[model samples]
Target: MSLTAPARLGIQLQPQHATYGQIRDAVLRMEDLGVDVVFNWDHFFPLSGDRDGLHFEAWTMLGAWAEQTERVEFGTLVNCNSYRNADLQADMARTLDHISAKGGDTGRFIFGTGSGWFERDYDEYGYEFGTVGSRLDDLAEALPRVKARWAKLNPGPTREIPIMIGGQGEQKTLRLVAEHADIWHSFVRPDAIAHKLDVLARWGERVGRDVSEITVSNELSRGRLDDDHADALYDAGVRLFTLGISGPDYDDAPVQHWLAWRDRRNDAVGVDAA
Candidate 1:
């Protein structure tokens, strides 16, 4: 709530209209370019452009990224909880965490997740298209199970996997975030951040947990990163800024610019870049 965190840049390399080879190349380029975190969306199909565009699944690509990139943390921007079993999700996250580990340290895997949205993904994949409340109810039920599974896994996680819950719903979503997340990601406008944070704080008090360490996150606008916008959010307690990039050709220019911005912000704030 004090609006203090090191500046970090994240890239959501959208897995649509591109070959697996191209996606892999983009991940390597992002890591080389010094982006703090790289993410892919959890959808069965494209979220933009052509509804039927060629698209890749999220978890599979993350598996490849775990083996492929060394320094950058990687995960779904928000994995849909409806598609996979809760315990299975926990195991997959732990396995990927181990896969990404290097030099005896734990791997960088953020278990980013949300209640299922995007009806088409559910309808086409043969998953039940439940109402919003039902889906959120499912997510609430799953989180505890996921944590329980993580505890009971054979070797356990390399480290405590960071849970990132993405959403801004003041009622259920923010409450869940207060209870479970280390990072809270949303696409709210700059002005809305304060109100959302206030809601989160209230939830934290009700839940009897300290939510101050939860890192705030938002998406980079479609245009170039705006200094005023970035400053306002940073002032309001956002550390991770994510840019969503799509393919056949995954452009690196925007990512590079934001990475530069991240560096400058970190320097200005005296926060060391990770």
Candidate 2:
């Protein structure tokens, strides 16, 4: 199996009641900070304490992010696949790919996605939430269609848009990752992730693919990923670590340590050259 690892740092800029101007500036700042990838969650409204809170739609901001940032690759950490028509999602991705590649380079876009989760999103928008199983089933069905649409779309994504699947259900999600994702993001803790990854490997074997092509990623939680804890995740093959922070008022304080750790990992793991 190939053993190449992804660059070890990404930052998720959560749109927690932030003004568009603030978010725009923050994206530029994150690129300046040498972050590899910048991400935003896909939700119509905030998912935090106050449900009835300010928020922004995912793709519109991504188009702006594509134009605003010069270096860092950007994407939604997890766009809800069910919200937009799969064909439309393909079109949006294709346009953003060109937007990011404006000056003549391969696109810096990762098409991260997951099945829709928030019931509020469905209830308000008139989508059927159905069952969790049903949603995942829909995701499994939609992914290939989305990919097919990507190929058929005009301009065709300036580059291959890496597919990022986020979830940890061993039965369904991991299998989907083995079959489709170029990257897999999950909340699995380091130790638990080790076990689950073995399952993913088995799925890869079953499907005649190499698991190494899929980078393992996990959330970089402030409360959980202490210095030693970060090391543990690295040891478990989680090279793409993402720190999710909030807005209106942006704070990089919680992520400074993680950033430092990423540098340290780079030094030790050859990401210094990435």
Candidate 3:
């Protein structure tokens, strides 16, 4: 099957293990490189070893990224919905939406969220990281409330901040994706992704929503996956791809390949159109 033109390409600039100065430079470089979206993980500390390692808060850095970047859309890859009240999250998203849209383009913020998993994050932060089922349930409940709050908000979310839900749980997460997410993010391989897409479609059917309306996104490694893998994913209805990189120095090499692939995808779409 021929892939459709992707809506955009993105990269996650993880802020753990990096100095603020380095992060600032990398964000600037990514904008120059032509990435459509730039994301950072929402975490208090490094997800990897040395739990005490240096890290920056997600939203605070997002505010800074809004000022520092010129063209790249910025947001948390997936904020833990369990950590903040849904109303507060909606308000924060609205505020940042305006901040990112200061120059008068519809806001570039995607309110990415999920029922968080990390046990340490829950224990240390005093959030309930109960069973995965419970978390997903909470997320499903919170999402509509968020939308309602967004509508009631004074600024009314610069341009309807797109809601992105990240996870690969076939039963629950995929259903949430079908029901709530404007974009669904998964890290599974192509074959797994294909199967899950079927599951998501089924869920969409149950909920009376078109699965195609939800964007499929996945986390990519720096050249670790094959080039054709992108074509495979795009054919499977994943129009948005995200590569992950760590800072102090956000290496430009991986992002360059992503940009190249994005161009190729666009070119292919043009060919198909002709």
Candidate 4:
């Protein structure tokens, strides 16, 4: 476990119940608040609140965010691999990477991807809502193509955009994470993290890759930063902690709370967090 890894904070500004202007402001506010990464989910519809609500697309908004902020790395919390062609996805990611690269610095784009699971999204978006195993198979097939396309692009990505794979399935997901992911993100609880990492290690050994360097990430959506939950995640070897906030009024209180906790955690470890 990489317990010595530096702690970084992230937020998913849910694009529901708000206009693009509000979402744009929230992104700027989060960047100004010193969050390391800002994420938004890839879904055509809202995951919470009213089923029919004002929401925005993920990748296009990401392009805007790419040009909007200078320092904070941004991407989909986990892109649905089933929606677009793999090669096209890579091209889009590479473009965003270049767009975010300003003042001669590497782009701050993280390619966080996952196999699609939301049936409603698939049903409405005219995509196949296949079974979980089949969707995993599609992601397994797509990832290699995405990588290949990246290598073949005319002006390649500014940096090898970090791949963050989000899932907790002990079998296929762990294997995929061991094979390709730079960051393994999960909604798994602290107690379950060790068990999952154990599973991941076995997969790593199978794939002949050392998985210890892959940054472990977990979401704080289930508990407040003031609770022991965040610390428990830290103890479980999670270096990236993210909270999801929604719109209408994107509250900064939680972001402030998380920022304080992140500062304290990084300071305790003598890590100079961005």
Better of 2 and 3 by TM-score: 2
**Candidate 1 lDDT:** 0.90
Preferred candidate (lDDT higher): 2 or 3? 2
- Tens digits of per-residue lDDT for model 3, 19-113: 89888888888888888898999888887656788789898888888877766788999898888999899998998888888667777788999
lDDT of 4 by residue, 1-274 (tens): 5777788999999999999999999999999999999999999998889979999999999999999999999999999999999999999999999999999999999999999888999998799897999999999999999999999999999998899999999889999999999999999989999999999999999999999989999998543554488889899999998899988798999889888888899899898776
Best-fitting candidate, measured by lDDT?
4
User: Model 2, clash count?
Assistant: 0
Q: Provide the clashing-pair count of each candidate structure.
A: 0, 0, 0, 0
Whichever of 3 and 4 has more TM-score, that candidate is 4
Query: Which segments of model 1 are wrong by more than 4 Å?
Result: none
**Model 4: CA > 4 A from native:** none
Q: How far is candidate 4 from the true structure (C-alpha RMSD, Å)?
A: 1.0
- The true-versus-predicted C-alpha distance at residue 68 of model 1, in Å, is 0.9
Candidate 2, superposed: residue stretches over 4 Å from native: 1-7
TM agreement with the true structure for every prediction: 0.97, 0.95, 0.92, 0.98
Q: What is the C-alpha RMSD of each candidate to the true structure, in Å?
A: 1.0, 1.6, 2.5, 1.0
lDDT of 3: 0.82
